[model samples]
Target: MGSSCGPTGPEPGAAAERVIYLDNAATSWPKPPEVLAAVQHYLLEVGANPGRAGHFRAAEAGRLVFRARRAVADLLGLHNPMRVVFGANATWGLNQAIAGLLRDGDHAVTTTLEHNSVLRPLHRLQEEGRITLTVVRAAGDGYLDPDEVRRAVQPGRTALVAVTAASNVCGTIQPVAEIAARCRTLGVPLLVDAAQAAGAVDLDLARDGIDLLAFAGHKGLLGPTGTGGLVLADDFDAARLRPLTVGGTGSRSDSVRQPDFLPDVLESGTLNVAGLAGLAAGIDWLHGPGGGPEAVGRHELGLRRRFIDQATARVEGFQVAGNPAGPAVGVVSFTVEGLSPSDLGQGLAREFGVLGRQGLHCAPLAHETLGTFPVGTLRFGFGPFNTAGQVDLAVAALAEICRQERP
Candidate 1:
């Protein structure tokens, strides 16, 4: 599994002295060196917009962007790279898919485990009287039943079914394949938000029967922020979806009508080319020569297991939000009996240099589903860069934080 792209931990220093970044779910830090180098090269040597002009540099930039698109498509199990439409992030992609496809009188189905990225847009549409919405609730363990989703879908009435592949707050991996199977049989398109599952879970859009997928580059994909997109299945029709934004696509110069093409229709205006370059490097690093997602997933899981084992055994008042063990991703979230999440998170950051997420993590219903609303749990999103030593130090810090009384 050794490769130049493998995560390299912090340099030698006291455990408390170094910043133990545990908020990988927000955005990954200490990005792979290859990602940094690729970005620098793009900004310095190849400084031109893709598809904007016919110059040599522009053509090369376009080529670089296409390479990234291909990498993303392959990673997500798509046969055609052109189906990957770049966007600002998973939120943007979700809005495009949810808002664009659902028309008047259309009905949409979703789950409680989804982040606000999915909920907000769908709610907005519901409020506007454009679409009818059905949100299925998950169990306390954060698992959504595929049959529940099947029951929610109305044949020829449900336009789309949206669900999360993994919960950002609880790290539960939903039964997307089974859900997709039901949707396929009922003639409904399934859109999965893979923000937390892209690089951490085994997702094959074709095999899983997923119609559309939204992913974040910075979270599980280990790419730079401001990089992410929507991936369409080979058989899915891109024409059904409308553009979220439209501007200079550098195509169809004669007319102002938005070019109705695979990428040009959805991807308008200039893209973050430098960021895309870095994203390409990140994707290549994961699949080119290293052990890929399997190696990384195992590493993060080991770190999660280490933290849970140490924290629950050595510390008091440590209760995780969901089932401690399950078919899920690498995120672990817990609440302390004597301490509030904000208080504990502040103590970890100020006293021990351990940074983690607190509160509902922008997933209010997810916390409500877990019965942890109003007051949420402290979350530690394990990543490939995190080590067991760091987890040990974090556990020790948590013990100290719990020992102290409330203010």
Candidate 2:
């Protein structure tokens, strides 16, 4: 798909050029024009608290949110939109899933490649003596073996298996289908954190045997920040979970207790109407011509291949992290010898006007698994708006920085 701005030439003077954003995994930039238009439309034409009032405006707001829910459901191949619940972000959704499902003495298994969103919650649960956690170690390349996960599943006690569809740091796509198959055979619920893979790859909940899918709308979904959701299969009962939040859901107004339903049971507050409106538009764009997950993934892989070839050949002391052969989204991380990732990131931003992410990327476990802890690798995440020229520019900037630092 062509970028929002048509075929502009590269900015002049690499050091003084306009900013080139390569941090889509953190949050996408230059959102689709339709997304901005939808947000504006919601704010100007229909601004009302959704699911709260009977007026036309309020009803329109509710419809917009519902349409967003339906769009997300369709994108993920979910049958029921009610099963998809929105939250502030993926971390919030993940916390709700973990805290709601696991109980005292129940066992849960997860891979070492999980982000802090998954690890921190499970850690707290473990510390509280609520559940026993079995962390299946990944290979040195940050790829988890499905057999390892299967081995970790203790049949009767295992309640859930939490795994990321792809690592935000290393971009290693897990074998979620295989893991889900094992979970199915063992009768354990499989929850996938698809923060990095949602809009970059096709995720069929039924086909993949995924019981629960958590995704960040802002990252790969090309939506605004504070938009994220969870998809629950019909077989996964909400009754098994404790409501993370309890308050007005615009349902059961006379009752004091929260409503016992899918969305209202968990939503518990005023919805992000504008954000959802944009998100719905973004999903629509994704489903439209040349903008689905497959097309996006192929485009990104082409960029990644270019980056890998150029950086490895030109930049000395730079090594790509994780298994180069593993399937990945648009995210790529690499380490530079004798330079802190933060420093490199700063230089890239200040000198080259290239915006990229640094540090452990909220996935300390992943960095630990990749042996890139303490000093993390520099990450460049591509978005739908990024171009091949931007990738080349980023690589050239890195090579120049290395030369300057060494010579």
Candidate 3:
């Protein structure tokens, strides 16, 4: 962070293997040592269901869960940890927020730069005639206009406005804060899919006026795959929303009904306590000596810039999707002439040990917004653990792939 952090050697916790990992958008790899240790400690020492029993191990597990909930809340700028609901993944969080909040005949607004997590739920609701949906289009570069979002929200009818903080495909960080401000002015609830933006960019849910923030632990938080949740704004009323699931919360043992509380309302049954232990350690590691989000952002963006410049200059017929001249996360989608995305991605991995994702990357609408529909671009997602030298090697592999394609 103090230096350019240019990779003269392997990144922290990185392996010596030649297989380079670049698909960080789906899930980060080589998690910090602390995360792994936390998980192991939980499994070995505190193997109990949190808030389920009066046993000491269960209490300890409950404490671990609370710490993780608080850390996640603090990460998003919320003071109340109970406002955060831990679930299986960001998709679960999004589904809970969308399905639990909107009622029959209610209308919602979203953008084209959305992952299927947000899209499928809303589409299902629309198909079921439960809610009316309005999808706002983003620019070719995947930038969504806050004014366009405001125009889409029908003052009293629009119950929720769901949008991704960044594009999972091209790494375009949307003006979510601006959209939040607009939603606030219009008295509408805003749910942000922070699967991509959580650790890649700075997010202040309270400061940004975001009512509900859904994020994944595995992707940006560097936690285990089963950990993620939704955070409710401090002043937001929980009574306005309902739980998608209702069963034993371990607190409402005396009553058959779900507990009418912040976390218990949404979080039903057993949670991923082991995964949450990893998430807690991951958050601390992220903001500790390893690097905060700003440092991580700088490192990844610099790597992205390096790859883009080198690939454009050295590889013939290399083309990148989206506008490359703005503040963005590390995900970059590109194509080479005379090659399909899957072929190039496979070639890069098979021939040179470079790993990256090909195809829509679960964001077909994002690909369509960038005009890379049906067929997709090979995507490289740089992470905080990535290095400049790694990008250089990947770009060289890409150049070679293009070279073979040319002949």
Candidate 4:
């Protein structure tokens, strides 16, 4: 493949760099400078348990948490920040949403492209005889047909429909808007797992008809690990779902039962103050006056387009996966002929210092839908810090590896 973009290395006086980070989907790298600063500041300046005390430090911590909630709410175009409940990660949020919503005899629908987070919980519920689940099949590219979802919905019995906004393995963006609209028409709640599309795509809770959205803060949101949340729509009440964990919420001290409130009801133990502080800073950096998710998304999309073009043109025996026509975020996945994805991933890291992810990417169902199960595929996810030049280098490295490893 010809290199259309120039290389992006360290500055003139800077020391040598180790590797090119391309595994943003697993967890973003090179988070904004403000994110690090915010984490440090929180740890040093205001290290206190939020909502646990009335002290200045405690109040400050509480304010930081609230600010993060508002930031997430604004990003999703949600009106109430309280509806955003912080969790350990997207999986945690998904567990809370699924486990809470589904009850005995309730019927639910989900896509075959869902990550383990959604599938595992639903499977457990099925085993326990709590709810009946229907796994809707996606196309070869992992694109779920909204009509499939509509057909799966059994008006009175189907209480909720869970779907992924984008496939983590194939980078196929689903018709979430159409699915959500169908769910709304059927009066069934729609829970969206935006772990792969949150910051890389524009999502309006109201316009998109998303009743519940689970996202990872560490991925596209550019926050530290252990930061993620579930944004509940106004019509969707958190009370319908039971708390996953309960301990100290720093509220209703006198009562033995947990407080029944938006955040307080869901947030049990002490929150990840440092991570939340960084998450707040990250949200601001992404949605500030000049900076916005759309701007960052465009940059990522350019890199994806460049990679797709280069790989399609020159990389022999390589097959790109996912819906080419549908709009994708920054994620892209492909398989090299006669080469195991794990081997290609290791070669990219060891030989070329290009860090990309391999295997099922915690979404075996997605690979199963794409017909790349067990062996999986190599995934290269773009970030705000990633440049088009990096995309060129990655493609070149893959092509070279294919040539050298030709069977």
Candidate 5:
């Protein structure tokens, strides 16, 4: 993790065919072998609908699904596992929370650091006159002050305060505990979009006073896509939150009405059992004694520091979005002179086989906040499996591109 690791970049002539992947922000790659095995086990060995039948396969599937729920709960430091609800992804969970909870005349407070998953839905609700939305602005450094968030709450009118745990574009970790405390003081429900923070940060849902938390299984959790969930607080009243979809939950069969419980209320129809199986394995690996969020975060942060330090030193006219000194969870966005983000990204891929994400990163407001609006920045997201060598290669690739394009 230190400079003693030496230059890990590729050799001068050995760059063309080697692949350097630094796009973990979108979705993690080279998933843990345990995740793949778990998915295969679910599909091949226990190919049965969970909670639908009394047979052995169905029972195994049901047990696996329940274990996945508990694994997510444990990962987030929630004692009651029933509060975890499966969804297609964090977007699905965010929609359920935004559309289900807020009603006409209700007010909700969010920030510019949100992804479209949060912004679009809130905008729609505001446009439809369902809820009055207030977007609190973060500081120029991309850091949101808790007091500023508190001032945006409308007391009796504010039904919910939604926010992202970290910025997806520039990787600024928000002051979640401070904001959660303010929300608790106002007796307003808090919903956290944890798509970037799940396995990259240590989140204590109960201790942090978060009412609801939404996270993606594919990113930090190292699970397959189409796997994610929302965790509700123990005291959270499900009656206030409505289901986006209602159908057979494999329970409450006698009545045609939707089940009035924790998970069954939110999860309806056939669940993504295979994906959930992989998610469970991912969480298990994350929660392993030697490997946890604390360890994973430290590893990613080291790599992030290495990349940022090298890039800033080597790339001329390099501009890093957001406060480079601020807290982050392994994501960095930067721009070089005389190159569009797309062009720079493409050049890295074509010339160096370095894969990175370019453009607004699905968070235009975040770029707007960073003053990189229309053009955006090249983003390199590090994962647990990413090494110092990979980070070095990316930096060298960018440095080379910057030199070639600028001169």
Candidate 6:
């Protein structure tokens, strides 16, 4: 557990040395070597526009894109790879799903523990008089009961139900499958944001009954930035989803009209072939022989347990945000009595080179639910690249920092 496949400190003679990196929830660092290599191969060897031409390099580029879609499909247990569509990131994917699914006066239900990506879009739609939004508050521990979701959806009136699979701030794993069943019963389509859950938790598209699933490639997927998308269910009609952007999809170019196909219907313009190449490698690494999500989860959970145990024991006024007994990923949020979250985070980085995130972690509603809003909790997010020694370094840094600051 000391060192694995993830990033470590900077090399000698490097001016700004990196120490312990615990901000993986924001974006995983030190992507697998395979991922970097795949990206490099795409840039150097497979240089061509995919699906835009019929040349050999273009075909290779298209194959790279196709392989990426299949990799993501395999990760989500989706049978049809064509149902997956690429975008800039999960924000793009979420926007497409939310904006495409709902219309004027249509009602949608969501949870309080949502990132701005979900909240902002719904709020914009609501403000525009496009859809009526209902926010189901989570329990004090950041847990949402499926019954609460069931109660929020207005049966036939609710057009869509959106929820994050895991809280970005506190790492609380929601009951998406249960909520999906409820959505099914209510005849409502369910859109799940797996930004925090993908590659950290298990997700089966068919088994979970998720109509639309959006996820980031860089987070738990361990891919490069600017790569993410959504996967539509097999029976889910692409015709219902209006294109967020319409342009040359490299298919059906004769009519100058948008193509009506699974990927082409949503994907327009040149695809991120290089980014997808790395993403595909990341997914393959996660599901392949060298590494898997199960192994990664176990490692990160061990680090989480170590940090929580050591921090609570060493720090006088330490407080954990969510219920530790509940299901979660490798995220932990806490606060100390005397030090502000910003101060602690900055001090950790400055003094010990221990990188962590502070504030609401881009999920204000989550912090509000955890009663840590306005002033948020310090967040430590462990990843596959992290080590047991790094966790110890973080704990020691926290203990020392708290001891020095406390009266």
C-alpha TM-score for every candidate: 0.96, 0.95, 0.97, 0.95, 0.95, 0.95
Q: For each candidate, what is the lDDT? A: 0.87, 0.86, 0.88, 0.85, 0.87, 0.87
Query: Per-residue lDDT of 294-318 in model 1, one digit per residue for the tens?
Result: 6677677777777888998988778
lDDT of 5 at 64: 92
What is the C-alpha lDDT profile of model 6 across 23-70, one tens digit per residue? 999998767778889999999998899988889999999999999999
Model 3 C-alpha RMSD to native: 1.8
Residues 145-233 of candidate 3 have per-residue lDDT tens digits of 99999999998899999999988988888988899999999999999999998887899988899999899999888899999988999
Off by over 4 Å in 4: 1-16
The top-ranked prediction according to lDDT is 3
Q: Could you tell me which residue pairs clash in candidate 3?
A: none
Best by TM-score: 3
Q: Model 4: per-residue lDDT, tens digit, 1-407?
A: 11223212123122114667889888987777788889999999999999888899999999999889999998998888999999999999999899888878999999889999999999999998889999998988778899999999998999889999988877777889999999999999999999989887889899889999999999988899999978899778777898888877888889999999988898899899999999998888787621577777667777888888888888987788786445788788889788888989999999999999998888887888888888889999887777776777888998998887777
For candidate 6, give the lDDT of residue 275. Answer: 95
Cα RMSD (angstroms) for every candidate in the order listed = 2.4, 2.9, 1.8, 2.9, 3.4, 2.4
lDDT of 2 by residue, 1-407 (tens): 34432222222244323888889889987677788899999999999999898999999999999999999999888888999899988998899899999989999998889999999999999998889999998988978899999999998999989999999998888899999998999999999999999988899998889998899988878788999978898678789878788998999999998899998898989988999999998888777743588787777766777788899899878888897656888788988877778888988988898898999998887888899986889998877767787888999999887777664
* Evaluation by lDDT, superior candidate among 2 and 6: 6
Off by over 4 Å in 1: 1-17, 288-290
Instruction: Look at candidate 5 and tell me the lDDT of residue 106.
Output: 96
Q: For model 5, state the Cα shift of residue 350 in Å.
A: 1.5
Q: What is candidate 2's TM-score against the reference?
A: 0.95
